[model samples]
Target: MARVLYDLYGRDEQLRFSPYCWRVRMALAHKGLDVEVKPWRFQQKDAIAFANTDKVPVLCDGDQVVADSFAIMRYLDDAYPETPAVLGSGVSYQRALLFCHFVDRQISPALFRIVALDLLAAIHPDDRDYFRATREARFGCTLEEFHSPEQGQALLYKALAPVREVLRTSPFLDGETPSGADYLLFGSVMWANIVSRQAPVIEEPLVGDWFKRLCAAHNGLGDQALTVRDLGDEQSA
Candidate 1:
């Protein structure tokens, strides 16, 4: 079976930085699976039409085609039962799913607003118009008008309050060990980290430390991402 994952990329094809795709990437790593990660862009819906979805993070595992991050993770667990469970069983999976929902509903919005313009700047040239149009239509304002660093930061911190409390006491979301919940949160924070000049998660020491640890997991997988902050650090170095 040819294991392939269509991951979203930015202006630089090497910069595969989609939150949903990151979730899948870490899930694959957690399961000790090897895959060919293909760089996909916002305007490349036709490329994934075979999967019946216009989104990246589409996993093609031989005969199986799975779309959506959560579904893909479920597929991973089911298809490779011998591997470590990505979503655990019933109750545990529900808990992880809740975290996924919280990140999508609360954290992702703030992160998006925080990096709205920066994200625009980083998108592939062919995707710029599509990104700007869809985003502006959703928010009813231009990216320039929607960009709210202060408010986004405030909202992000507020949404992360419970998460901070958890991290203060436990090393990971699943307590001692990172779980599906960890990947979901990490993916969202990574979206901001890679696209924005600043990583808001760094302001919260406990959560930031947890994030750092997870980045170093699966062989420094997340840490290897080409973050905006990394570029600045490189230039300064």
Candidate 2:
């Protein structure tokens, strides 16, 4: 059995939903790769040292160690091309890159903002004021400036607009079935949901509905998701 060592716990544990990791998870599942998930605490860096990387979501199978999630997904696609993780052929690869590149340029920053606000909210109430002050100083922007709800929504909408367009034409982002683009959109939306409770403001409700559908389709992994440090008594065990 392959062993998947993940940063099950960390300050930014929510990074698990990162487009990078989400793609890997989808790829692995699509390939029917049986894996043993080893949840690692943020402090247990030593535990994953043998995996040859300090990052979580490291995959070890037999004698191979796959570090980065992107690498892992590509490896899975090439090694098990039967199921085909990517959509289309050579030209389709370029199209998939377009989606990934668009996501990197647009959706990711909004996610960062939402995440920062959520982290600030997690601070002690008494310490929140001080924390915001420090954050403002560090970012050269006041809490009020950083916490613009409208701005956050705008960013999210801008990012999601492209995905909506793709979904409008095709059931999935790329075509009939879930493609690399689908995984990217799923990861971004999942990150938005986990990191921030609010929905993005947009004219099209199709995006939100699609997100709901995708969440429902993948709900089994919801509980298994090691986003937060609470794995139901990880500390006790």
Candidate 3:
């Protein structure tokens, strides 16, 4: 049985920069599962039609096809019981879900405003208009009219206060190691890191150091991500 993941990408197929997909990628790595990742673009709805969803981060594990990032992570723990659980049970699971919701409702929106234009510059040409049309409609403003970088950065930092407080003492959200909550927030941060010319930073030593450690986890799976942080100087030069 072949394990495969439909991951979202930018202009360069190698630039798999979808935050949700990154969540799944890290979850899979946590479960010690190796998958062949297929890059999907915004205009490629037909490609994932079988999953009954237009979104990427669809995992086809043998006969089971799981769509949605969070759903896929839950499925991994169920199917591969021997692997490390991405989400703990009881109160732990509920807490993780709560944190995920906070990131989705708060962190993601502000971060998007910061990198929306950078993402526009990076997506496949065929998906450009669709990306802009949908995002602009959702945000109620043209991408160019969206929050300025300075504002976006400030908003991101403010929204990240909870996570920053945690990292100030704990190495990971789940104490010594990572949990579902860590992956959720990491995905949001990766969104800013991968596309922004200058990746948004919140408390350089706190969040910054934690992010570096996350990128190095799962055998450097995320370390391989195509972050503009790596090319920011060249792009500006």
**lDDT to native, each model:** 0.86, 0.60, 0.83
Best candidate per lDDT, number?
Answer: 1
In candidate 3, stretches whose alpha carbon ends up further than 4 angstroms from where it belongs are 200-203, 228-237
Top candidate (TM-score)? 1
Q: Which stretches of candidate 2 lie over 4 Å from their true place?
A: 10-19, 41-43, 87-89, 119-147, 197-204, 218-237
Between candidates 1 and 3, name the one with more favorable TM-score.
1
RMSD of 2: 5.6
Instruction: Count backbone clashes in candidate 2.
Output: 0
Question: How much RMSD separates candidate 3 from the native structure?
Answer: 2.4
Q: Can you give the TM-score per candidate against the true fold? A: 0.94, 0.72, 0.93
lDDT of 3 by residue, 94-207 (tens): 887888889999888888777778878777768899988998898889999984777877887888888778887899977898868889989978877887765554446788
Q: Rank candidates by TM-score, best first.
A: 1, 3, 2
Quote the lDDT for 109 in model 2.
Answer: 61
- TM-score, cand. 2 vs. native: 0.72
